[model samples]
Target: MRFMFKTDYEDDIKLFPHSGYLWSYGSLLLVLMIAPFVLSSYLMSQLVFVCIYATVGVGLMILTGFTGQASLGHAAFLAIGAYTTAYLQQFGVPFIVYFLAAGVLTGIIGAMVGFPALRLQGIYLVIATISFAFIVEEILARWESVTHGNEGMRVKTIQILGTAVPRDSPAFYYLCLGVLILTIIGSLNLLRSPTGRAFVAIRDSETAARSMGINVSLYKVKSFAISAAIAGFAGCLFAHKLSFISPEMFTLQLSIEFIIVIIIGGAFSLHGAVLGAIFVVMVDPFLTFLKDDIPGVIGGLAATLGAGAQKASHIQDSVAAFASANGLKGAIYGIIIILFVLFEPLGLYGRWLKIKLFFQLFPLYKRATFKRQKIYVKSERNR
Candidate 1:
C-alpha cells in the first residue's frame, strides 16, 4: 500500500492528496470528455441526467452528509429553479443569468425556511423542511398566472451566444459536464475552508460546535441556503432537459428520491452522492425493462407447472398489474432504504472502500477495519 506522509499544514487541504487521485480523476475526466462523441443518443441522455442529479446530490451531501442537517424539501428549491428558468427563458435572457437567478432565489427561500427551524432537531427539522416544500407546491399550483398550475409551463431550448443548444447534442452534454465539474470544485473548496470545518464540527455535535464559538444556528441556515442553491442549479438543467416544468414534477416523491440518491450513494461522502445519482438516474429504466420481462417469466413458470393457457394468462396479468402500480416502485424504494440501513449503512461507496481495503490488506485484512467507533462524552468525572 502507498503511504502518504504529511509534510506541511497545506497538505491537509490539498485538493488531491497524492498522485493517485490526480491520475485517476484526470483519466476519468478524459473519458467523460470523449464520451459524447462515442456514446449512443440514449446513453448520452442518461449521462446528462446523471450529471444533473450528481450536482444536486453534492449540494445535499454538503448539508446532510458533511453538515449533518436532514432536509426533505429540496424538491421545493428544485421547483423554484425550474419555474424560474421557465419564466425567465421567455425574455431571452442570457442562460447564465437565469440559471444563477434560480439558485439565488431558491437559496434565499431556503435560508428563510431554515432560520426558524434552527431550534428544532432530528425529525422535527425534517418536518419543517417538508412543510416548506408543501407550501411551495401549493403556491405553484394556485399561482396559475405564473406556473399555469396543472397545465405545466413549457421550457425553451437553451441558447448560448445566439446559438440554440439541443438537448441531445454534444454541446448540451458538455455544458452539463462543465456545470458538474464546477459544482464539485466549489463544494470541495468549501469543505476545505473554516466554514466547512465548522459544518463538520456541527455535524459531529452541535453542542460542541457552539462551545467552540461556532455560530451553530447561523451556519445551519447557511448550510440550507447552500444546499438549496445547488439543488436549484440542478433544476435549471432539469427543466431544459425535460422541456417543461410542472408542480407535480417537484413533489415530495422527488425529494425522497434525492434522499435515496445520497443514502444509496453513501452518506457523508461526495463520491456517494455521485454514485447514488447514477443509481437513481438508471433505476426507472431498469424497472421498465423488468416490467416487460417479468410477465413473460410468470407465464412460462405457470405453463411449466401444467396450468392451462387461461390460467397462465391470468397469472401473468396479475403479476403485470402488481408491477404496474406506482406504489410498487415507492415500496421498492422503502425496502431498499430498509435493507441499506440494516445491511450496508455506509452505502455503495462504503462497500467500494471495503473491497479496496480487502485487496490492499489481503492476508491481514479484518472486518474491524471498517467497524464503527464508539462515541464517548467527557465530563469532570469522566476525565
Candidate 2:
C-alpha cells in the first residue's frame, strides 16, 4: 500500500503524485537505458517496435479515450508519414525536416477529415473512418510515381548529426526510447492542461460541454490533429526500423491492431498504451513460433495416440495447412477482442488497479467491493 498526502493545490495536479511514482519511474528509465547492453539484438528490435506502437496507441487513446471521438483510420496517417518520409529522403532532405514535415502534413490531413466528420457520431463515425482508411490504401496502391504502388519503397537509414544510425544498433534503440519518453512527457503534460479537461468534459457529455462554453467542434478537430501527428511521428520511426514499407502494411487490420492495444491496455490511461504495446509485441513472436510448431506438435500427439503412419502424416498435413492460413491470426485477434470486451472491459491496467487496491485493503477487502451492478433503468423499460 502506498499513501500520498496532498499538501497544496499543486500536489493535486502534479504529474507524479507521490515519491513512490518518482522512484518507480526513475527505476524504469534506468532499466530502459541499460536494456540494450543485456538484451539480445532481436529483443532490442522488438523493443523499438513496442515504442513505435506505443506512440500510436497513446495518440489513439487521446482521441477515443479522452476526447470520445473514435478514429479507425489512424493507419492512414501512419502511411502518410512513412511515404512522405521516404519520398523526402530520396530528395536529400534531412531526417529531422522530413520527420517533422510528415507529422505536420498528417495533422493537416487529420484536421481536414475531422472537420467534415464533426456531424458524425457513434457507428457513423466509425464507418466513415473505415472508408477513409480504404481510400488511403487505394491511393497508396495506385499512386505509383510517389509510393511505388505494390512494389513498395525502401527507407533511408536514420541519420542524425552526420551519423547514419544502424537499424540494429543500440544507438537506434536508444533513439526510439528517447522519442518514446518525450511523447509520454508531452501526453502527460497535455492531459494536465485545461484543454485536457475540456476533452474529458466533451467525452462525458458533448451537450453539457457545449453548454459550459467549450468549443466542442474545434476541440474535436484539434484532438484529431494531435492524435494524427503523434501517429505520424511513430510511423516515421517505423519506416526506418523496417527499412521498407508497402500499402499492405498500413491496412485496416493494422488500424484494428492499434485499437486492440488501447482496449487491452486500458483506454483511459496513458500508461496503458505502453503496457499494451509490450503485451502485443511480446506475444507476436510466440504466435509466430506456435505457427511454426503446431503441426509438429499435432503429429507427435497423433503418434502417441497409436495412429497409423499414413494417418499421422495426414493429420500433420491438415494441421500445417490450418496453421499456415493467414485468416487464423485474424480469428485469434477477433476472439481476444471479444473475450476482453466481455470479461475485462477495463483491461489489464484496470485489473492491476484492482490487485493493488486489494492489497491495500487486505483483510478489509470484500468480493463485492467493485462488483458490477445490474441496474434496470426506466428509460430502457420504456424503450
Give all candidates' CA lDDT scores. Answer: 0.91, 0.90
Candidate 2 residue lDDT tens string, 127-147: 999999999999999999999
Each prediction's TM-score versus the true structure: 0.95, 0.93
Spell out the clash pairs found in candidate 1: 265-272
Error (Å) of candidate 1 at residue 222 is 1.1
What is the clash count for each candidate, in the order shown? 1, 0
**Best candidate, lDDT:** 1
Candidate 1 lDDT tens digits, 1-383: 98888999999999998899989999999999999888999999999999998998999999999999899998989899999999988888799999999999988988988789888888999998899899999999999988899899999899898899988899999999998999999999999999999999999877678889999999999999999999998899999999988888899999999999999999978899899999998988878876888999989999999998999999999988888876878898899999999999999999999999999999899998988885644532252
Which sections of candidate 1 miss by over 4 Å? 304-310, 378-383
Could you say which candidate leads in TM-score? 1
The weakest ten consecutive residues by lDDT in model 2 span 374-383
User: Which pairs of residues collide in candidate 2?
Assistant: none
